[model samples]
Target: MNEDSLQHPKLERQPMEPRALKSIILSTITIVCAVTACIPLFSVLIMLLYRGGKRLTFQLFYTLPPGAFDAPGVGGFGHAILGTAFMVGIAGLISVPFGILAAIYLAELGPHHKVSEIARFCAKTMTGLPSIIAGVFAYAMVVLLMGHYSAWAGGIALSLLMIPTVMLTAEEAIKMVPNPMREAAYGMGCTPTQSLIKIILPVAMPSIITGVVLAVARAAGETAPLLFTALFSESWLAPNNPTASLAVLIYNWSSSPYQNLIELAWAASLILVVLVFFLNIISRAVGGKTKL
Candidate 1:
């Protein structure tokens, strides 16, 4: 051996050090657990495809539901699809502004104020509020007052379900804005309102949008609330009339004695799943663009 090598001897390499072995063991366990968890999700997706895919036809998008006593497979739930869109649109209009404004107040304007604290507490409490309760509230507040089961009541019911989700998520997004941005805005003599509008809000907008999309997805899948407020209809959507939504359709048809109606329920279930999946994808995509 050379003199230098003899003076500075190299240690023998281990095939597997204890830490490395432990890491490998944990990684294997994690992967196995992750894969096991995904099995049920994949199984459900496969089942949906098998059962619902067969009924997906052009007519399914354009025709009304078949009569309960009519021939099998003669009609579709186009009205329900339209009603779902209308009520969700109305819910978005009602909730998005209120939720974002509440978030702004919580995260910026008066985060420590007593009123803010009360508002925050109310929002958190609402997050856990059951869909059935929201439905009941809408029924009592809107349906009874309006003296009818109309699309307006349904939209109001869905808006209640959406607001808490949007507000909490938006507050988190706003709070994530770097303090340096706020400081710099102040250093430039910008008012708090100006800074919020020009800097903080712009930076936080992507995440806010993500939250809105997620809230919409959740609202779209709600059945209990729509059942109480919108009820169900056999005709196309009307603002002053009972509405049909995919969730309600699925609930109403799933227990039917008719095989065709049961199949329609499966199709509606598949559509609702796909809609929620796409909304989630959109949320993730928008969230990826958040400045902070």
Candidate 2:
């Protein structure tokens, strides 16, 4: 062949492919969108820190809210902080086991079955369900049974909101484990249950933790559900008692006629935002450690 014909035609066309150009364009758009999304989030964080940082104090974590109309430095958010921790902890306890187990059933034990499909649909649906609806459900189910609002009831409401996210995340994580690993476990005389308990769960643990952290972050920032079920208290949160939460306190105090309480509210808002931010960071770290 002549020199001109001998050089591959594909080499000449490599730089001008329409498909490659399209992919570059699409990737650039995705990056721009992601950066754009982060702007509003960083703006919120800065705003909260500026508005609330002045009111944050050591006492904020150790003492109760002070007398009405007290100065900004006089009172703290101890009750709200404690209550938030307790209520969210209870919610975590209630949701994590059920969500993980259900995810295991769907992803590892019964993939492609009709019942699993139905359950997965229900979980995905719940993931989008309004937080207030979960609150209402908890109110009707738990509060009506007990005749009053309590921290446990608030937890039940939050668990409902948390469960769907956890289930979806865990299911996705479990699925990320390769089919070969499962087959190997089966090859080694492991029962399906034993394989799930040992091989699948251990492999998926990091991602599952990431999911739980994200779910808790979402639950922590919620207020509408707590409004209906938590029934905020200004005082200490007992286990079976209606209790204050940081979000609830922020909502109520932000509109106060007194500037000090308003400042306290701002501070609580900052704390809540920080906590959620921390959880997100942990989730990201754990997710990065996963091989996938």
Candidate 3:
């Protein structure tokens, strides 16, 4: 046989089939559909940045809203900004410990146990529950009992929202820690709690931090729950006896008749987006480093 014919057998030189071409075409279509779904979110963000760009000034960060019928570029969201931070901080304080403990229980004790199974079910249910429902629950349980809306009430609501996120992320983080590490700690005469705190937790800190960051971001943007529980304020600053938050302010301004208030709303939104974006970036960087 000729060398050329021997080198390239008939089967080896076969052309690409129509079925393979169809599979490629279908995969391309699936990718296009996925990209198309993201367009609306991109468009909304673009519109917000464009409309709110002119009002994004230092004064917006420094001053409070002037009032109704005021011009586009007036007052800032300082009070709201401070309020959001305080509320979210309190929420984090409330959620993080519980979440970490729950995660540890799930990971260390094994999820196959009845208690772990129940905990997992509860977490899943809480995760799927509506934000408004959480708000209502807080209002009924905390606000009504307290006789009015308070920062504490808002913090509790945010904590409820945060717990599931933290728990799930923490569980995943704990699981990510290699089993050999735990075994090694045990081999060295470390107690279960000691191994968890000294070895597993330190190793999983990055993932836990990432989860906390994400939970904080979500809690920061929550409006519906804050509405029923936190309520809104124009005069009283958050961290006051009773707190007010950025989400409440945004909700109030966006629904107001005044263009100035609406503009302030947009500016507040820009601030929130920037804050959350930076948080996510930090979380990713830390997670990546720890992963390495």
Candidate 4:
């Protein structure tokens, strides 16, 4: 043995533990399964891009759908885009205030009350409610009452779906505010209302906005509800008439015998996917900004 060997002796390598080997095997399987799951998603995205990218044009964003006798690729779904935005805006108006109020009640004012418990349970149950049921409900309540399909009916339909998501998320976000912050506010002579308005709301706003955006995204992509409520329009969006939406347009066009309509459907699908993806990115950005 040399001087170097005296300073640092070589140690014998031990065999891998059975538990360690099992963990490695399981982890590898998990990774493989995750990759396999992503394959279909990536494949669909690729197909959308390849089939839809070529059809995108400036005119497509502003022009109306082609007439029955018109040539292929002569029109667009601008009305549908506007109609989707209009209905979603209406939904936000109807849902946001109600949801926030309910959240405040559940998370702060009457958190331990029986009513709050029941309200919370109902919200959770609505989360899993079928979208088509909401449509039917809206049709019965709004469309039938008004005696026609209109954007208002569509908005009401979307609002039903949006409310539960917003209420649940806002409640969770409000609950996540630190107890220390609440205590500090109370100690500093702040009333419960003042503290909630000035401190709690501002702190939880990002997360609440995240939920709102997600709800809007879901509403924008819904077709069944719109079909039962708004129906479909080929002309410009009118408040008193049936309105178009990208979701309904995709459904109507995708099955058409005309090649152009099918292509436009693909394009509409791509646009809808991109819009949802963008909303998700915004939600992540806003949610990540606040630690609470």
Candidate 5:
């Protein structure tokens, strides 16, 4: 070979300008699409606040609707608010323990066993199941057992919706716990259960709380399940005795012919959004504190 050919090698090269331009264009397009999709939700929120904020008084929180269009506001939503809280609370109570335990059992005790596989499959299946189906299942199971729509029935439906999410999230959180910490605990004479409780759990608490907050937010907004299982109330004040939730009330009011009812529905939607937002903020704060 000639000296030039022996000393020099062909250098494969790429044009930096085209690649950079293509990446910039793709990023811009992606952002634009995301912003466009978010617009409808933002618009609805703005419209709600503008048109319904004036109607959202302290009285609206406390009173229920009157029988007549012109009748004085005869009732408050204290009952509905309480009902929503109770139903969601009961659902969380049912879901969190089962989910977290199942996740622990799967991760620590039986990673590849038949039972764990079945549990995983069931959780995945449940995650995609519709809220209405959960309601129907609750109605068929618990409501039939009780012979009526009750808050417990509603709770069962919400639990069905929540458990899958909790299980998946718990598993992921536990998995994220550093193996070194677990080994250290084990080296220090900690049992598997003790290590899980004291080390893994504390370290993974932020993720667990995030999962719980998301579950609560989802359960709060669910109307179809409550509609079929809990039913609705016009004047009922107790959740345990079958009462309406804010979601059900919003559904009823938004569909009513009266403009005032529609306005109330918008106001209720705004309140629900605000409550969910605050819950998310609190969840973040808790997560941050746990990290420290």
Candidate 6:
């Protein structure tokens, strides 16, 4: 063929066909949908910063909630802050080990076995359940038994919410390890157990840590579960006592008629959002350092 004919092949300057045009349209739609989905998140962050940023003060960090409506005082949510930490700590204690072990079993031992399949199915199913259902489960199992709401009940409810998240994330992390890495360890006479403990787990640690942190973040902001399990306490109390939380405090104060309480709720919401943001940052940092 002549150079001109070769340069002007049948497809050279042809427009995209109907099928390709439709695909391009669909892809644009997908992008638009994804961007649209983020609008609410952006709106919330903006609203929280605007409403809450102005209300923050040193006293907001150290003081307790206001006293009775008749003799209201300038105070903050120190009790709720401490209560949130206490319950989340308890949740971490319960969920972290159990989740890691379950992930190990699923990824390192019998990923395709019947029992593993059953476990994975359950985890997936549990992940779909509402936070309120977890609260109800904890209420029936712990509150009914104890005859009252307590931080323990709240912790358990949060743990239930954390487990499936950690499990699925950790399992996928472990599975991401190369098959050749295990083979190399085996060639060096490492037992499966040793290889798993020394190689696989270390390799997977960053992702596992990230997963656990994310789960903890999710647990930290849960309100419905704490409402059913902790029932809210404004007074300073032990972990065994009914506890207040940032989420529940926000929920309560947001609905209150008092302007000050509403302001406090806004502040608490900002703090919670900041805390979750930091946790994510820490996770990314940890994950990055491990890979490096």
| lDDT of candidates 1 onward, in order | 0.93, 0.90, 0.85, 0.94, 0.85, 0.90
Off by over 4 Å in 4: 1-16
lDDT by residue for model 6 (176-278), tens: 8899999999999999999999999999999999999999999999999998999887788677778989999999999998877988999999999999999
Q: After superposition, how far is residue 174 of candidate 1 from its true place, in Å?
A: 1.3
Error of 2 at 211 (Å): 0.6
- Please provide, for model 3 over 1-292, each residue's C-alpha lDDT reduced to its tens digit, 9 standing for 90 to 100: 8999889877642236787778888999999999999999899889879977768898877677686656657677787787788788889999999999999999887768999999988998998889999999999999998888877788899999999999999999999998889899999999998999899999999999999998998999999888887787665464424666777887788988888888888888888888888989988987886751
Per-residue lDDT, model 5, residue 48, is 80
Best by TM-score: 4
Per-candidate TM-score against the hidden true structure? 0.91, 0.88, 0.90, 0.95, 0.88, 0.87
123 Cα displacement, candidate 5 (Å): 0.7
Q: Is candidate 1 or candidate 5 better by TM-score?
A: 1
- Candidate 4 vs 6: which has more lDDT: 4
**lDDT of candidate 2 over 40-62, digit per residue (tens):** 99998888889899888898898
lDDT of 1 by residue, 1-292 (tens): 8998999998885659998788889999999999999999999999899889988777888899997788867799999999999999999999999999999999998999999999989999999999999999999999999999999999999999999999999999999999999999999999999999999999999999999999999999999999889999999988899999999999989999999999988888898899999999999999998878
Q: Give candidate 1's whole-model lDDT.
A: 0.93
- CA lDDT, candidate 1, residue 93: 99
TM-score, cand. 5 vs. native: 0.88
Candidate 2 Cα lDDT to native:
0.90
Among all windows of 10 consecutive residues in model 3, the one with the lowest summed lDDT is: 235-244
Root-mean-square deviation of candidate 6: 3.4
Question: After TM-score superposition, what is the CA distance of residue 275 in candidate 6 from its true location, in Å?
Answer: 1.4
Better of 2 and 5 by lDDT: 2
Native-referenced Cα lDDT, model 5: 0.85
